[model samples]
Target: MRIRLTDVAKGRRDEALPPTSLAYASGEARLALAETEQRPTVLGLIASGRMAPDVGTVTIDGRADAATLRRAVALVDAPDVCDPAPNVTVAGMVAEELMFAGRPSNPVSARRWLEAEGFGAIARTPVADVSPRERVALLLGLTALRPGVEGMVLVSPDRHGGHPAEWWELAESFADRGFAMLVVAGEAAAIVLEGRAPRADAAAGTGTAAEELDDLVAGSGGETPAALDSDLVDDSEAEPATATAGDVAADPAARDGSAPASAAEPAPEPAPAPTTDPAPARSGEHDPIPESADPDPTPEPDDRDEPEGDR
Candidate 1:
């Protein structure tokens, strides 16, 4: 998906531009970093992973870089990023460098070491008088003291002017030797790489490109009235139906094809009166039958054989 960086930075991060991709989504820092100039160092550090991004993830190759890059990559800022000892000569310091390197003993011979490292005459001079590059070289040399330094980064190198060809050729050689580089340049830089700009007509045409999916399907006779189902549900709760056949017959849609949704089924008439014999009634409320209706006149003999109720 193509995320709108502007909206994300302004609406989410609040940064002007993103420091590394992470800060781009920061709801606050983004508002401050959007300019072509006047950027903060934390932004660069965030990109390098020494600091954190406010929004997106940082990756190298395909793996996340925030963890790995912080240790592997070093940033080079031009000139004077250190302090010096006044009591010691350059050679004395270079000889004692082994102590600072965690060796602390069995130091290099100063006279022989100074000559071997191309600082023989200058070795006797105090470090405070040396050029920035000399100090940088000292700092850079210490990186290798760690025993497994694979590479280094130099921001502004000496050979960038009339010697551009030679310097770039050296960079090409370094790349061939598998050194990853990040070179920064000043205003007077002479080297150039060719690039092409997109044609105006092509870009404009693409920008105005239209979508016909909805319109084409709509006009293709599928989304028209004929394509719509008449049986589809209507809005609102249906009322308990009291409608009869005459009311159902008056609906135009029902006449055309649709059914009358609220029409009720016709009520059935009472069944014809059932035929049965008339039943006779009792004379008194408490009596079962009148004595006059007795058909069996004779009485059966009592079971006990005691005549009448004399006892």
Candidate 2:
């Protein structure tokens, strides 16, 4: 079975996803570049026939049949879509996926399944806490179990933060087992994989494989995918660049359209000149006069005992 996406794209021009083309046949794992949380999901949705692209076509075996494509391909771990809840235990998630595959979904069965899959230790662990490699392996394994799924489109496994090789090797293993695998990842993953591809080709003595990988990367674009990498940057991880008080003060262009403060407003009047010089200090005595003398004063009579009414 072969799945080909020809110039497939979603959303308006230069938004969401740009026109992308790639193909993966059975027993082959292909990597496609799709930066940002939304683009991976969008590409996975279109590639798996869950969404209709705004342009181009996705054909399975040269036939543009959405229902067939949907049945044959599984869209795995798309954020806000098929991804298991973060708070769900690994066992609980496995059981749910087992149920979807029409298998036993009891806790006991789930635990036993985990044990068989070599993940029994993490049975009680939250899905969110699962290691990236383990999570990707588990999800892909579960999706493969569902009847009629011959291909899998894994969306943004790189977002889980692991060396790309770990999951790529796992996907290649699945492909070796006659499954069509497509990984939708960011430029970082693409770069890592592209660097490794030549080495892999040299080791395997297959020049064609390296050439194909190069073509895939080139088709995505150089240095960045068609989608802006800047948009893909996590807002929490990197603060947006802003003009600080110093920056604004130093950079005239950083200021708003309003005129400069000096130009826009009047200067203040000079502080009133001191009315009188400060009184000189007397040794061992507090100054008798105030610093600024009162304009008029009511003089006090000498401290003499004068008669209240001198007759």
Best by TM-score: 2
- Candidate 2 lDDT over 1-311, as tens digits, reads 76777778788784888978777767878887787769989989988999999988777765678998999999999999899999999999999999999999999999999999999999999999999999999999988999999999889999999899999999999989999888888888888888543221122223254344444444454344444344446652576454468967886765765544544368898776465874565454434666688734766654453444531
Clashing pairs for model 2 are: none
Tell me the whole-model lDDT of each prediction, alpha carbons only.
Answer: 0.40, 0.79
Worst 10 residues of 2 by lDDT: 198-207
Candidate 1: stretches off by over 4 Å: 1-48, 65-67, 76-113, 126-139, 156-177, 190-311
| C-alpha-based local distance difference test score of model 1 | 0.40
Tens digit per residue, CA lDDT, model 1, 1-311 = 00011112211354533422321111111111222332333333444445444555444323444555545544444233213475567777766654545653233466565677677777778876765556545545543343332333333433223433333344344334443433333223322311221111122123211212222233344352433333222311354545566866887876677766543567678675445842443342222346678745575755644444422
TM-score of each: 0.36, 0.63
